[model samples]
Target: MSLGAAPAPGVLEERYARLPAHQREKLNRIADTRRRLDAAARGAYEALREAQDDLRRARAALREAEEHTTRRTGGTLSLRQPDGRVMEFPARPWPPPELAQRVQRLEADVARLHAEHAAASAPAGVTTRLYERLLEHLGLRDLA
Candidate 1:
């Protein structure tokens, strides 16, 4: 029963068999809950990573656009009229305002994803701790 000692073969199975039906059911329920929490946490973590990648791409695009705009003249296209008259058509910046707006939106999305990741991670951690404690309480810490 000591921490350094290993249980004999089939000991775990024997102990589990000796558990009361209600207690076994409760353990199963806790295990199922832990699995669900872990799944949710993984999903949230993936989403967070994806959001961060999207934010990075958005930022890079915005930086490139800004750089292009700064290195170029005002957005204007000129054409020579049929009568030899020069006409200029005014236009927006090289990178439209929408790109900047997209950057802003992506930043917000990254923040939201971070929050969601933390929310999901916290529950998974708590569940793991709870399960560990349950195993210890059942004298099955080795199973952890």
Candidate 2:
């Protein structure tokens, strides 16, 4: 059957009805297994997406905090030279204690998010591997 265009509405049903009873039963079992595997894959993908969103949020928060700190402390410095000339320099101060602590917390949050993302991705990888093995066993390795 061509995949580019779907079969007519009842074509699948008619084909299945023409099959022998034993083959129909086996096809039903395979369909059920495929449904379960698809659900598992979708769940794993959702988990990975959530983890990625969390990581993005944490990184955004860290960037905002750092920008705020920089804005507050990144001022210009000026000095009067002994020859009555004025010299100007940029003054970018180190992060204040509070800002430092906040940064440290955000860094930890990012690390945790990274770990969560990895954990969530592992299940999806395992599902793909299992599905590939199943296809190979069924002599459908081309599908894999």
Candidate with best lDDT: 1
Judged by lDDT against the true structure, how good is candidate 1? 0.77
Candidate 2 segments exceeding 4 Å error: 1-12, 71-144
Q: Looking at candidate 1, what is the lDDT of residue 80?
A: 55
- Looking at model 2, which ten-residue stretch has the lowest summed lDDT? 65-74
lDDT of each: 0.77, 0.57
TM-score, every prediction: 0.78, 0.44
Badly placed stretches (over 4 Å) of model 1 are 1-5, 71-95
Worst 10 residues of 1 by lDDT: 64-73
- Model 2, 1-60: lDDT tens digits are 124556557765665577678765765566566666566556666665666666567657
Cα-based lDDT at residue 32, candidate 2: 63
Query: Relative to the unseen true structure, what is the C-alpha lDDT of residue 79 in candidate 2, on a scale of 0 to 100?
Result: 46
Clashing pairs in 1: none
